[model samples]
Target: MIKLKRNDKIGLVFFLAFIISMSLVWLFEERFDQEQWRSNPGKRYKMAKNIIEQDLLDNKSKEEVIQILGEPVTAEFSDNNILIYQLGTPPSFFDEEPQELIIVLKDSKVIHVSVNQEE
Candidate 1:
């Protein structure tokens, strides 16, 4: 039979709490990862681009972009109000670069779309 000392019991409680909190964090993180904003080379982003082109959503209002693409991963820049869609490719897992779909906006309208590959 094993009995925990007072300090040992306190330490064990803290340890258990820590482990449970961490597990909860891990679970929620997995849920958050599945959110649309997490930059992936999946068909969703492709469909987003296609929406911009086919629906002529490009050159439209910011609301239009949001309606099509959902919330951006980052802010629209202050200077040019550049809306950046950061994308990652599974095939480029070894590559440390992230592909960017940069939507340059002026007067709350998309003016240019640049596809940049970060190196």
Candidate 2:
């Protein structure tokens, strides 16, 4: 039979607590970042608007969007050759209230873009 000593039990308890705390921190960090981002919806919306207005929609590529917006929060490519660039808080935490930018691409070129701000 295997037996754990008193020190071993103490170490195990501490290790479990440490893991739980880390998991909680990791989960909450995303929520905190989203809260901070949503707090400035105007700024984020303006950024998206500028990307659509100034850039040449017909010639703009994915790389160009990245250059203009730094990076998107999420991206999705469909089988129908449509690419979507989503910016703002992820949907996991902000399920009911979420904001995002939808950039539609056709043949690797920007065809349409829309800023969706959920209230």
Candidate 3:
């Protein structure tokens, strides 16, 4: 059997590294594709609108909001009168700022649903 020379060993190492990298990339291709890397302001706004107009806010409990919009990334309760739910990625070049959905409740019913889009 022939032993590998110094250059041959270096080349073999580089080849192995490349193969490993390619294999990892191939294995994770589907996950990479599923990630949302670009901003779709319109789609996010539409989802927020649907959440508001579809009477999703009729249920006043936090669990109801989760059922309607999946789990919110952020939630706030102030004085039991105001509720804020924020969703999506934080402000960035690749994604619009998190969208805030404010629900004003009266008598355990939604009195107003406000959709705010960050600039």
Best candidate, lDDT: 1
Off by over 4 Å in 1: 1-55, 90-96
Question: What is candidate 1's lDDT per residue for 1-119, written digit by digit as tens?
Answer: 89989999999999999999999976654221234544444533333344345544567888787666666666655664877665554245576455666777789898876556745
Q: Among all windows of ten consecutive residues in candidate 2, which has the lowest summed lDDT?
A: 29-38
- Per residue, candidate 2 scores C-alpha lDDT tens digits across 12-86 of 999999999999976654221334334564335434544556553446787775564445555665433334444
lDDT against the true structure, per candidate, is 0.61, 0.58, 0.58
**TM-score, each model?**
0.49, 0.42, 0.41
How do the residues 1-119 of candidate 3 rate in per-residue lDDT, one tens digit apiece? 99999999999999999999999976654221111212442234435655565665774665565454455444456546656655444446876566666777666666788877544
Error of 3 at 13 (Å): 67
Our tally of clashes for model 2 stands at 0
Q: Candidate 3 — which residues are off by over 4 angstroms?
A: 1-44, 59-63, 70-78, 89-96
lDDT of 2: 0.58
lDDT of 2 at 67: 61
| Candidate 2: regions farther than 4 A off | 1-42, 55-58, 78-98
